[model samples]
Target: MADTLVADLIVERLERWGVDRVFGYSGDGVNALMGALRRAADRIEFVQARHEENAAFMAVGHAKYTGRVGVVTSTQGPGAVHLLNGLYDAKLDGVPVVAIVGQQNTSVLGSAYMQEIDLLGLVKDVAAQFAQQVSTAEQLPMVLDRAFRAALATGSPAVVIVPHDVQQQPAPEPAQEHGVVTTAPEWRRSQVLPFDADLQAAADVLDAGERVALLVGQGARHARDEVIAVAERLGAGIATSLLGKPFVDESLPFVVGTMGHLGTTASAHLLGHCDTLLIVGSNDPWTEFYPPPGAARAVQIDLDGRNVGNRYPIEVGLVGDAAATLAALLPRLRERTDRGWRDDVERHVRDWHALVEIRALTPADPVNPERVVWELNRRLPADAQVAVDVGSCVYWYARQLQLPAGVPAHLSGTLASMGCSVPYGIAAKLHRPDRPLVALTGDGAMQMTGLAELVTVARMWPRWSDPRFVVCVLHNGDLAEVSWEQREMEGDPRFADSQDLPAFPYAAYADLLGLRGIRVDDPERLGAAWDAALTADRPVVLEVLTDPAVPLLPPFPAGAAKLEQMRTGLQQEGAAGRHAAELLETYAAQEGAGR
Candidate 1:
């Protein structure tokens, strides 16, 4: 009989925890682990990502889409270090992930061996819940148990560092005694209802104010029905943080879009007019975007007690799951009348939508990026999952993309990492092969990480029967976000030498790799290009030559200082100054008039 190796035991335990696949790159340091994976090929699949960073991101994206613990592996040193960014993305977003990295052989413990670094030291801060290196075969099962448990409990990244030699040793034999490793039941928790007193206090706060508004985030995604019920009971207008876009139906009369710099004008109006704010399952960092400190009395509910009132000062803080809390609290609340605030906000939303349509339909020489995103939004399938990159694309998505209530999107929420969209889309496609997958990235972001992962998509495309994947590149030939930021913040002309990127033929590059490539340089060809990419026979790359001069400003108002700063910068710009200045002034003036 073959002795169970330490690597084999690790794979066995992962399968027990319901992990069927892992994303990683093979290396000499993890040779034994790779060999064990090969042996368990039928039960578990190994996805080869080009860069170790992309491997980690794929794991994060898989976790996001499936709501499971994402897993990724890498070799020692640089491979281990490369996992930090994606791990931190998981950490900051409060998603569960487990990272397994190989280490130098046990024999080279004290010596500064080649490709040997302190793996734990590099990852401890980011992998918040658990980070440890296994020293012996006996420690393997128990440590893996603890790591998985901690990730499940806290929704944070966990790390396990196994030395090369340690992975090749014999596994600890199964014992009759039960523990976390062998006989621990699934880590499922019973529903916890909020206390009567806390519920009453929250009800009292809601009852006192006539104009109540709701602020939601990703935590409220599963509790949408309960949230809408509470809103109906209180006549509350709903607004979301960027991550909470899936929490409510955007088409609802009083349901304002996201609330932040990327938020809608309607959301701003709703948040400002409310005398009471009900924050559910979100820790919104932008304090100014919410009601003023003394203006609104606040009540908050969250699954984690520590997050209660963390983002805003609250009169009543109820610590329970969003659905449970809302369900309990709704019974005690009195139904309120519209009081005309809802109508006002709804009108604002309608006007905002009209403005957005006008801007989207307005034709330019090169394709308008806003129009491209708006077109995609209209054409996207209901079940599709989109992974949007950072930079100027954030403005278009946050402003123009009307995400349906049930459709899920993967954005670099808090971290706002640039190159996540392509890899995230690949992961989404791998998880849900039937659904349409789209990766929206700026040219710079695509150049950074999206281009490298094309080969990965090409490799995996043949395996799935219906692999509908599209990588939409907004090739604006510059980092438009940074350029706008430089002008708005520093009152300086965009430093062309630093911010400008050469015009790269991304569509041709895709064609060279034997994928369907569609390029749209004119607005007339834009509609067909999107249709072609969406219904292509193989994975497609749709590259659009968008205008670089478009301002990436949000619908929300900029303060006086920001407006003046942007004006000064625009004045310094050569011939393109007046149009940009007028856009800023027009929005700023409208904001003042509304207030």
Candidate 2:
């Protein structure tokens, strides 16, 4: 029997770091590593994704849903390259993920051997916090420890590159005598909070203003009660970035919906009217939606100092954990006696909800995409986790779907990458197979990556405790988001060759995969379809043929400019633009009435 290889040590280190699974694909460059994983199968399960990119996405999803450092592995060259998209998602969203990449043998350093591309250079940007190439077996433990530590501390992607020869080398034991470093796999969260003076300053900002607005991002996930407490004390209305939507309970009467181009009119009203703005744990890039620079005095609280005062100019910045900072600041905050601002917030929220219902009930060519997700609001399971992809479906999800309180939902936020829904759904499911998952995606995204990831779902569903994985596809036969963007953003007519999607029977394909499939075109059948999917014995794909002409309406105030732009663009399209124009007019009218 040969001595245990360095690859074995790597797996052992990961186990010590509390990693339960690794998502990846294999190739010759990682043959030894794969063998070690097989040997350590009892310790750490290896999840084989259909592609390298999906594997990386799974890692990011794991990090997001579990609040642990997600790990991914890939072979040399092309496989290493394929991990970029997923890694970028982690970096941009501030999720922690560690990538273990295989490299060509060190002996072929300058020879340009097969799969010889430089791995360190490729990952440096995405994995800026930490990226190292291990040349010796003794370096593995330290490198792995630092990678995990950096990933967790910085909340970003980290990469470790091991050459084929290095992976095959004998595992090294602890060296006690000299400069060689040894490490243990451990990380803990610090109770981080800002100085007392800063907290008072932040509280002062909230107390002095009669009209205050609160913006929550994913960072405020654990501080739900604290956020509500602050809002109540300040008599402030709450708005959320799309990423923060799952963290806060949208069912709260004064809580307006998401903020952005796809956000709710109520949120636009709250932000526009408030004199003071409090941003918690969110670095949302929707600057245009924020109260025009000088309009609102801002106070931002973030664990990271780098993110403080990043999105909006602020009167004060508190670099601290959301819950801790809010709790400490609570004593300093004065309760507002006035109820007028609170009344305004409640009114806007109620009107917005009524408006969305009206939009959902409006007739379409086949089915309204808004209605598809709107239906989920009433039927979504309390324990269900949601994963959304980028497209028009994102607009619907942002505007309509009301997640049950405490149900965690995630997506490719800052990256806005398509085809992440299925992969993210898989990660969330595998982490807690007892909980059901819901994935919302557009037909264009299914074509991009969802179709192949569905295979991954099929392969894994048999072992899940609760096999209700519902993948709802908005099969609109067009890249509706981009099509609308062309008209709304650039004033250009729809380009058929570029915008149209080739028809695919998504539900039929799901059935072919031996999973239950439900196709609902009629608006009335949507409820039944969801019921069947949630109760099915196996995973289900619910495909709805939606209309492409239903416009992607921007939120109020911003929509004022976009509405005219949309009208001009549709008019330029001649006969083809008529349906879209009618829909846009209806949507615009609804926005005006709601606001």
- Worst 10-residue lDDT window for candidate 1 reads 176-185
Global lDDT of each candidate = 0.84, 0.93
Q: Write the per-residue lDDT of candidate 1 for residues 275-295, one digit (tens) a residue.
A: 999999888787778888889
Q: How would you encode candidate 2's per-residue C-alpha lDDT over 1-595 as one tens digit per residue?
A: 1489999998988999999999999998888999999999998999999999999999999999999999999999999999999999999999899999999888997798988898888997999999999999989999999999999999999999999999999998788858689888888999898998888888887788889999999999899999999999898999999999998888999999999999999999999889999999999999999999999999999999999999999999999899989999988989888999999999999999999899999999899999998998889998999999999988899889888887989999999999899999999999999999999999999999999989989999999999999999999899999999999888888999999889999999999999988999899999889988989999999999999999998887888888888888899999999999998998888888766
Per-model TM-score, in order, reads 0.96, 0.99
The pairs that clash in candidate 2 are none
Error of 1 at 100 (Å): 0.5
- Per-prediction CA RMSD (Å): 2.1, 1.0
Question: What is the TM-score (0 to 1) of candidate 2?
Answer: 0.99
Q: Candidate 1, clashing residue pairs? A: none
Query: In model 1, which runs have C-alpha deviations exceeding 4 angstroms?
Result: 176-185, 363-365, 559-561, 576-579, 582-595
